[model samples]
Target: MASWQEIEREFAEFAAKVRARFDAGTNKTIATVRRDGAPRISGTELKFEGGEVTFGMMDGSMKLLDVRRDPRIAVHSPTLEPPADDPGSWPGDAKLAGAAVEVEESPDSPVPGAGYFRIDVTEVSLTYLGVPADHLVIESWDAAKGYRRRVRK
Candidate 1:
């Protein structure tokens, strides 16, 4: 896994784009695993600051409980549809998958008594459609491989 600081340093431009997508909206989607192993999706707001991606939930929130049991998580950036006049104008979608570590709430935390988590990213990806000759472009960054690109027609 890599720290958000590392991602920023290594993939500056790409990271900027991804961060823009996240900043473009207030709510994003987070996927967690239930005790019975089924997937649960929740609406969440995250902060990408102080070299980490962090989020908090109301005390005893189900999603908070879910993360406490299993830290593994996947976060999807808010969806941004392509402009009506230009299908290729879409900025793309971003995803981050990793394990979250429970942390003590900070004084500045959004919810005073909320549970807090700091994400340790294992994978980060951005997907853009109809790019460079009608192909789909997928770019990703990982701790082991650093950076990679894949495309499909």
Candidate 2:
């Protein structure tokens, strides 16, 4: 169990790392499931506001449509880079993953071609990219399985 302050601090640090990566020109992938249950993926810029992560999407876009139709979404910051010398070399960057439930919908969206959608995040997980790996945090809704971490290697 982590304290609120501690969790807040962790999120701040995590957010900074994400911001830096994006600033340096790394694009993240947003994954969402449709009402019919098919997975949809799109590449986009992600912005973090305090603990909230926002996504800007186009109007009439399939991804946006899916999100509107089904708010349940899983946004991941996947490892887009491979190990340098060792195949197992870990970067130690934090990856945030979890469910994002729309909390607000704007009349105007920053997404490439139109309207905006804002969401109140229900669950989130943080994983540190490193060997002897450590999952810094896991937070989720009770009905949604919350957050859990498992190291692959």
Indicate which candidate wins on TM-score.
1
lDDT of 1 by residue, 96-119 (tens): 989989888767856765788889
Write model 2 residue lDDT over 16-79, tens digit each, in one string: 5544544444577777787779888888666655455666766777887777677766555644
Model 1 error, position 8 (Å): 0.8
Q: After superposition, how far is residue 57 of candidate 1 from its true place, in Å?
A: 1.1
Q: List pairs with backbone clashes in candidate 2.
A: 102-119, 103-119, 103-120, 109-115, 109-116
Q: Which parts of model 2 have CA positions greater than 4 angstroms off?
A: 1-25, 86-89, 92-113, 128-153
Please identify model 1 stretches exceeding 4 Å from their true place: 110-113, 130-133
**Candidate 2 accuracy as lDDT:** 0.52
TM-score of each: 0.93, 0.59
lDDT (CA) per prediction? 0.88, 0.52
